[model samples]
Target: MAARPGYRVAVPRTQPEQQAPPVQRLRVRYAKRGRLRFTSHRDFSRAFERAIFRARLPMAYSSGFNPHPRISYAGAAPTGSASEAEYLEIGLAQVLDPAEVHRMLDESLPDGLDVLEVVESPGGSLADLLQASRWRITLPGAGDLNGLVEAFLAAETVTVERMTKKGLREFDARAAVLSLEAQTSGDVTVLDVVIEHVVPAVRPDDVLTALASVGEFPTGIVPLLTRVAQGPLERATGTVRDPLTPAS
Candidate 1:
């Protein structure tokens, strides 16, 4: 092939990639509720990365052939359950006000999945700050399970089997539970529980299994579970503190 007379062939040019250093790490408290709660952790991560890019935030990325956004997530709530408290930290190339970042990201994300709070990390890891979690389970059309709960709590160890990637394993669900109480409202019975963050991470279903192991749990009743809080446990109060809140 030959170039036409009085014409020049154009060559393609590649743009240089520029890397920026992270100036700030923002700790964020978010929520997974409603239909969005069904979103898997991997799905949420991908959506968040897309949101960060759509919002045009100067996010920091790791160094590698396949660099990923510098985002670190604390223990995430299980899928198919709603959560009021969830935590993650993101590194940014430019320093920005936490409140502004919160508002921008909140608007950028979809409904249901919300950014509740954002704070400037005071030089600590988010994973280490989480010690316990508060959960609420609502069983509709189910009668009170007070006696069943009492029996389960009285037992020294309530073992339950769960299928993990490794294989089926049994663990003591009683030791991880800090407190458990049943409350009734109309036709729905709600169970409020505070569980310590431990190995295997006993979920609400595990507690239900323990309850069933002792006594009869109403069959065909699917309960609604929600994680109300997650953070450092206050031994005196037997409750978790907000990670974003500074100690008094």
Candidate 2:
């Protein structure tokens, strides 16, 4: 009898079983900052695929005509902003020594990108493991951020009108902001904002709205906004660095 479509005939076992155990999976954390941070998430994914090929890492691909390599990113950074800490995960075809894979990937990444660390991911996948992210936004000229930050903190609720695919939606920006702190860097003022993404997603737009409530936004494009770090800020023992630091 002929086999059904999309079905394969089972063959009798002829080979001996392997004596050794299979290799373990590895999860790597990579940081993309500076000019590279401005690249869109889709574009960055393509860039990393090419970089993986160049690095000769054993990346696994999906089983399809136009197969895509299995990879996952923790969160997306806004375009035009710099970031110190970003994350992505690449699953290997076979289990590899974490250190070796980390070394290979670091060498393959372009400037402004770095392999921060590599280890066995806590969960089955990176997406399952990620919980939250942290961001440090800098506004130009220290333009009355003191009043804005104070007002924002003192408010019971701050509502902002945001555009959604379903038209427009208004949300309490304060609810989205898990934490916020104010500081100054020479002339510019910085707001270290951390939002919980384990549930709802937060973006620079939310911050823009909150800032606008208490201060004036630049007439044109605003000053630099950079993502400082990502992932469970309190967890994960890895080498951490401030994104604003100059490349050594």
Candidate 3:
């Protein structure tokens, strides 16, 4: 059937991206130090993406038209809180030495966002291992922390309200608290506390609010909070075991 004098057909020229599943997954432990503690999660994400480019690591990308890096972050500390332990995982197209990646990433990022360690993931989810956190809260001019802590522990349920993403809500502050200890020096007091990660996420401020309700805690006292560690809760030792460890 050769009936047309002149006819042409347009054919699209496009192919699917050949992004592969990650061959190697590496978990990284980093620290948010100095003024960089105030960087929001979004800001840190952008900075980390830039660092990946600067380091020139071969990152694995997801399949599709708009491919993106295969990176995931777990249990980021709240904004404005300094942290010694933070965890993230990245998939790589080519296998690389974890130590070298750590060194390169540390060099690429700014001073404050320090790469503490990087290790090959044995198996399982990093987020699942993050069951608890240890924090040191320094309160200035807060009277008699020992008394306040004692009172807080004595309560069976200390209900407090906090403004969350879904508006105002109330939860039991005592439920999330695994342990609390206080040390006083001159006019300052430091609280060493272990908190279990729970729904609604009990924060240090919420604990203080619970204390105020339970005891005659002095007002107008400002506190500096820092997350020391976060990992699986070791029941026997009452400590957070390193999540990067294979056993955890």
The lDDT per prediction is 0.91, 0.66, 0.91
Go through the candidates in order and give the clash count of each.
Answer: 0, 0, 0
**What are the RMSD figures for all models against the true structure?**
6.1, 7.1, 3.7
In order of appearance, the predictions have TM-scores of 0.91, 0.75, 0.91
Q: Please provide the root mean square deviation of candidate 1 (C-alpha atoms, Å).
A: 6.1
Better of 1 and 2 by TM-score: 1
lDDT of candidate 3 over 70-111, digit per residue (tens):
989999999988899899999999999999999999999999
By TM-score, how accurate is candidate 3?
0.91
Selected candidate, larger lDDT, 2 vs 3 = 3
| Consecutive 10-residue window with the lowest summed lDDT within model 3 | 1-10
How far residue 157's Cα lies from its native spot in candidate 3, in Å, is 0.5
True-structure Cα RMSD, model 2: 7.1
